[model samples]
Target chain A: MSAAEDRLPPLRRSSGSVGRIALIVLGIVLALLLLVAPLAVIFAEAFSKGVAYYARNIVQADTLHAIWLTVLTAIVVVPVNIGFGIAAAWAVTKFRFPGKKLLIALIELPFSVSPIVAGVIYILLYGANGLLGPLLADHDIRLMFAVPGIFLVSLFVTSPFVAREIIPLMQSQGSDDEEAATSLGAGFWQTFFRVTLPNIKWALLYGAVLCNARVMGEFGAVSVVSGNVRGETNTLPLHIELLYHDYNAVGAFAAATTLTVLALVTLGIKTLIEAKGGGDPHRPRH
Target chain B: MAGALTARRVLPGFGPTMGLTLFYLSLVVLLPIVALALKTGEIGLARYLDIITGPRVLASFRVTVTAALLATAINAGIGLLLAWNLVRYDFPGKRLLDALIDLPFALPTAVAGIALTALFAPNGWFGAPLAAMGIKIAYTPLGIAIAMAFTSLPFVVRTVQPVLEDVRPEVEEAAASRGARAWQIFRKVIFPTILPAFIAGCTLAFARCLGEFGAVIFIAGNLPEQTEIAALLIFIRLEEYDYPAAAAIASTVLVAALVVLLLANWLQARSQRHSEKTP
Candidate 1:
């Protein structure tokens, strides 16, 4: 009886249906135009001058240096964040601890703080007159407006991704496998490498991919501390800004297109991993 | 035997874990926050109030929060529609469209700013048409709002999409079978389930827009009273070597963000409890 009732006739057509459809279509079209069209225009213009100009612009000394700096920052920020993620996940999931709730909130602090705030705090602590400034100068070490400053801010901005991803995965998996490994005479390190690491690897990778994207694309925080010293401190995003301001639209787009392609590639990898993980129940563990 | 052996081992538990967490937090997060608070403290409360309440800062606060709120509100409605369509409809290019939503997340903010500026400048493609109607976008508060909305749209869409997907269609079918109208079913059945997720998304987007800098600065033209956002104002202060003023402004944003985040977390917890009790 319920099955027959569920097959009731479809609703009658009304003028309101057209209006609703139109509204939804209009909203979607406007969003696509706003978000996708600008990038489209940039890509069109980049190729308008042929591949030679694109190649020349992207290979310029300053542009290349900026790209290198961006890559270096990603290299530094991603692995360290993954390590932090693993350790945090281990502590949070494997042990019942005091202040657990507070610690969880603290782990996500970077997510709530503005990138600009991250930059400001770094400046206040490491700039010429900052709290640690005098002490650092005494030791002849520099952080503000240097590579370390750039890396530090990037680290802060992308800090939450890995831990955020891995913690829940760890919690859901529980500690049965670790216990079994321990009973089999495995030490802490051995259990972690053999049992825990494999279970949370996908979450770890997902987090790393997300972290890399943010680190590569981060602008506000890096700009505040970078001093924008041309080849010396300009990352790819900063370089794009400077080039556009200098009326070098082609160069800016060339760099942007490169980053966009990188982003798409990472997103593809994430989708593939997620799909694979979904197909096999045990796959999420690895 | 296994239980006895496991119980016998001393796991280096809470003390080590808390110590490690605190050490990392202090080095990376708490210390910098303390420095910001300390710098603000140096300029007495009276002077700090003067800086925060000055005309320029006040204008920035009004503009940033107003634009963020407006954008987040718009996104909440539109993002829900988009999520609903994506989950319910079977259309060609659906996967492609879904992928495009994440473009803003992947695109660098500075590049986004530049691209938007080009598209909306007086001589640019779209600007040519809009300028005919005496509507200017680039280098205005309107342009700032548009940029903020563009970058922040994905946050709401992504947040609500999964929730919408999880709201099984069978309930809607059941409601319709009972002779309920479409709007009534949507209002009574679908709306309550997704409200918490929608609010969470809006809060995140609003917080993000308030702190946005790279995308706003290039298109805003950074005119002091007219288009300077709070984040850019902090940048200008730092550039002028006014650490105290910058700190004061930053602290204001920090406190505001914390309040919003706390409220959002509470709502999330409440929703979780509600679901647990019902389901």
Candidate 2:
């Protein structure tokens, strides 16, 4: 049923029923071509052999290691990003500040940056001939071509997710609740936990989900710093590339299937939260 | 500084939280971008320009810009239509289509790349039939554009959807009462409102397409100077241990991205100004 609020007066009647139908058809066709087809292709290509074969491809040592590393990266990166996102949002929205706009733009810098360049810059800082290369080498502290490198690049790529989500939500929410709680003699920690945290928890998880999604699926940046050392530094996306390059199309597709499933789970939860409608952080974006 | 002194909120943790936020932001985001710029600077102006403007690099730049433009153009039309439908019309599967629009945002880039390649590769499903018609998609500039279009599709739609949603139908009704036709009503009424957002969305999509590496590289077949994208070329430079060359080329993308981001921000600020004044 059309929303009565959205209904046009007879003067502004929609392009008749036929025009509406045409646009809906266009929308469906575009969605299928862009969204559904890619998803279907991944699933079909994965099962071109059989579920058993797909399982075998993913169960191998190298592939498993890639999966583990991807998850490990997310486990480290998501919380740190969550911390930064919360801190940034709290700082910008909860208090009066100067250069708040500049801070936000800086926080969102990675969003505009290419993953390839994001990787390269880290290399510039820590690679063999990088600025800290000598210091790192002397300490035998490996940053490039290691898990730390993967962790860092993923952090850069996803840094904005949680903060971007929380900032607008908090801005719109204002500091009213925190102020009230504080006036009632609530301490900083108490106000945060009792008054503020509950309000933004869903948004928090929402951002974490996005951060985790990007963490696992990040390719270009991680690929740059990873050196694609199979089973050592390869994340799931890099593992898929490795499989494809080795002419193991099935293996690649299988790995792709795993990441595809993760994407779906992320989408599922995001949709559920948005549907629940508790001050959805996604509202500002769309 | 004046605002901090004049405006007071009882909320605490600003100092601690903001301190951490600043420090972390510097470490991860600002510092890296600065490092990128600094590394490029260290190579000197003449050499950097030479490396960035070399024939192979120039050809890759041409391909990247052209493909990104093509993709952005396609997305502009389709995304406007998609946003219009989702906001104005309610239909069967509307929710599904609406949710799936975010799929590109969620899906791994490599997956989209390979999947598109599979669909358009010779001996594959769509590829075989298209090949019969002499329309080679895989491993061509068209293939790169297709991947670019797919990965960046959501930006235009998402950016415009909320703006479209906020527009009231009453304006269109008033226009129609004045004898405005459907097309005229949209052009004179609805289109003007969403124009800033549309431009913002298109620029965002264009920026994303410029930086896209995973999806396009898979489908483009990485034929340097023909279909090679700038991002992948930079990666290849890194692999060759030509760090100076990679940094120089990568900065061009950074510049493109910064321009687009500035456009988006300005458009956003304009829209926000409009929103604040609306009621």
Candidate 3:
């Protein structure tokens, strides 16, 4: 019935029926080819070798290690970024300060930077011949070409997600609630926990979800830094690259299926958050 | 004197939060940029120019910029169409189509890279038909543009959607009441309002394409002077242990990205101000 209603001509005509059909068909075909087809290809290739083959490939020790390392990186990167995000948002929105615009721009710097350049920045700072490299060498500390390097670059890449979400939200919500709470004899922590946290919780979680996805899927910077040792430092995306280069198409797609599942979950949560009225922070209000 | 003249804030966490914000910002962003600058500075200006202007480097820049431009052009058109349909029409699977626009952003670029490459490779689904017609997509600059377009697809669509939504129905109604045709209403009434936002979205999409790495590499085929992108070139330089050359090439890319980002920011701000002024 709804389909029949959609097929009916418009009560008020902005575009002709023929033009409308043409445009909708064009959009759908493009979405199918550009968006849906890639996902279909991943799942098809992943299961092409049979369910048993796919399962066996995923459970391999190296692949399992890659999964674990990827999870570990997300665990570390997400919460720290959440902290930074909250702090940055809190300071930017709740207070008047010097160089406020500059601070916001700086926070967004990672988003604009090429990930390979991000990797090189660290290399310039911590690689063997890097400025701090010699200094760190004397101390026998390793940062680049290791797990720590992976964590750092992931941090750089995802640093803005949470703060970017919250700053606009907190700004819109205003300081009135917190100010009222403070006047009512609430302490800082009490006001923040009871007032600010509750108000911004959904946006905070939305930001954290995005930050987590980026951390898990980050490739270029992590590739440049993580020496890509099979069981030692390879994250899931890096492992997929390694598998692909080795012509293990099934293994690569198999591992990719996991990240694919994560991407779907992220999209689901994003839609849910939007439905919950935590609407996309980046979208302008009507 | 200026600092002392302002009244104190009533907020409690300002000191601590600002402290943490500045501290972390320096460690994560500012310091690394400083490191980049220091390294680039170490390579004298003459050598820096020499490295960035080298024949291979110049070719990669040409390929990267050209592909990015092509991708941005496609994104501008398709994104505008998609956003228009999404905001203006209701179809059977409209909501699902809206949700799927973000797939490129959420999906790991490596997964996107391999999936796209498989689809466009000679024996793959789309590839077989196109190859029969003597058209090739994978392992060429065309593939690079397609990959760039895939990754940056959401930028223009997402940016334009809300702005389009904000174009009040009354404006169109007013035009319609005046006996204006559909195209006239759009071209005159609607286009003027959304132009700043549309341009902003295109600029941002272009900037993102310039920096895109993971999704482009697998399909790029990494030929030295032909299909290679700037980001890949920087990676190759790093692999060769030529730090100076890598830093030099990266400096150029970095500066371009920053400048483009600033321009996009300015355009977005202008759009916001424009919207506020409208109603």
Candidate 4:
């Protein structure tokens, strides 16, 4: 018998197969218990009273404001990173550069740095006694413990996503298309807008999706910088914490459920994108 | 060809690229790092050492490293098994299982923390059963480890999955033809091939655990010199307005992370070289 057949004999024999099937079933059950069941509990608890309770708690002014702040932060952070991503990818993949390795490493620094550390760095740079703090104070400027501080920390944490996504796509596609465009008399801007952008468009979208998810979900960095001011600086994640601590579990779970739903939707979208992008013959060539 | 050649030459190749790269690095990465170093310097080397090597800092480091290492080790085995099952098996709910693996990547850390804490608290459904066995999870180091493991599991699973899929089944069949037992074939053939990817995944998971804060903070109970992690310690220092001390602690963490990253890259490169030579 083939090795595959030999391995299957135990399965074919109902008596000996019981143990193996049981083991496989146990593994699946454990994973479900650990990962899925808890989420089910959270959702059930949130909606236990009714949709009215969820709607009322989730639509409260503070919760609404936190969600709005989170969306605003995503708006501010995603675009800046996308721009930085385009620039960095253009520079790294399109050119043979000195200090290229160093630049790549620097771009990835945020990935390695703790989000809490990112918050700390911003505070050191913009807090009242910070290096830029006195100069800002002279100008009556406030960066920390405010909206800008939240945005800044979000920026630091999510900066690497777009660049990382674009770099590999650009590298594999090469510079031939751009050169051909330029030869065909397309100007730099035109070449970029026409050839380069179209090619990296999918990657750019994927990166932006990832960046948006992270910025909205961020907690540690924003927590340190925002000072958790009730309605002023609180983001959704922080709002959940505040409500939970206040024994407002329903409100907290309502906010949590909203974020969770958003996350699940993003995951679904990402899966579809990956499936479409995977092994497709339509990818743009060098 | 002539136009392409001139474009290559006149397009301001390495020089401009290097200049932009350095400028960007200096602005966004190096400057902040330099500021951290200088702040630490202001406290003098002795004081910096004192703060970083203090009892609380030392305890945090020990706990963080211990928990991270244990979690990564556990993940390396379970992640590889899961990858193997996903790639080789034709099971029911396979699609659902595949999608579930990425949940940690998308779930907000704070929400995850809350969910985990609710499930593992003494009164929590899961925790209550375990608590009956006299094992405490919530507000303890075990809870920290579980949270880290939960968040970091995807890194290992995803990293190893693609590699396993690429490992053609024919090789395993060949080993079997050579009279190797199933376990033997796995150890001698499949294990070596997938080992590097597993290690890479473990390293990524370890680095993540080292820096994990959001989920851990909720469950770790944040006791000084006990449940406190390095990230929490840094946060506490910053909250107290102890910039110098915070910078000192952060620098130490940064240096440790750099070392792990270097080791990971080195292992990856070595594995690639081996594969290239063999093929």
Give per-residue CA lDDT, model 3, range B1-279, as digits (tens).
Answer: 663566643878888999999999899888878888999999999999999999999999999999999999999999999998898887889988988899989998999999999999999899899999999999999999999999999988888998988988777777776777767888898889888899988998899899889999999989999999999999999999999999999989999998997898899999999999989
Summarize candidate 1's per-residue lDDT along A1-286 as a digit string, tens digits: 2555436422222223554566457656866787668778778766768899999999999999999999999999999888777777778888875788888898889988878889999999998899999999999998989889999999888888888888888888888888777768887689888888888788788888878989999998999999999999999999998998898888888888888788778757766767757212111100
| Shift in Å, residue A96, candidate 1 | 0.5
Model 3 CA lDDT for position A27: 95
What stretches of model 4 exceed 4 Å from their correct place? A1-27, A278-286, B1-26
Off by over 4 Å in 2: A1-16, A279-286, B1-9, B275-279
DockQ of 4: 0.43
Ranking by TM-score: 3, 2, 1, 4
Worst 10 residues of 3 chain B by lDDT: B1-10
Model 3: how far is B87 from its true place, Å?
0.3
lDDT of each: 0.80, 0.86, 0.90, 0.79
* Residue B71 displacement (Å), model 2: 0.3
The 10-residue segment with the lowest total lDDT in model 2 chain A: A277-286
Model 4: per-residue Cα lDDT over A141-179, one tens digit each: 998999998998888888888888889888898888887
Ranking by lDDT: 3, 2, 1, 4
Please give the distance, in angstroms, between residue A141's alpha carbon in candidate 1 and its true position after superposition.
Answer: 1.0
**lDDT of predicted model 4:** 0.79
Note the residue pairs that clash in candidate 2. none
Docking class of 1: acceptable
- Top candidate on TM-score is 3
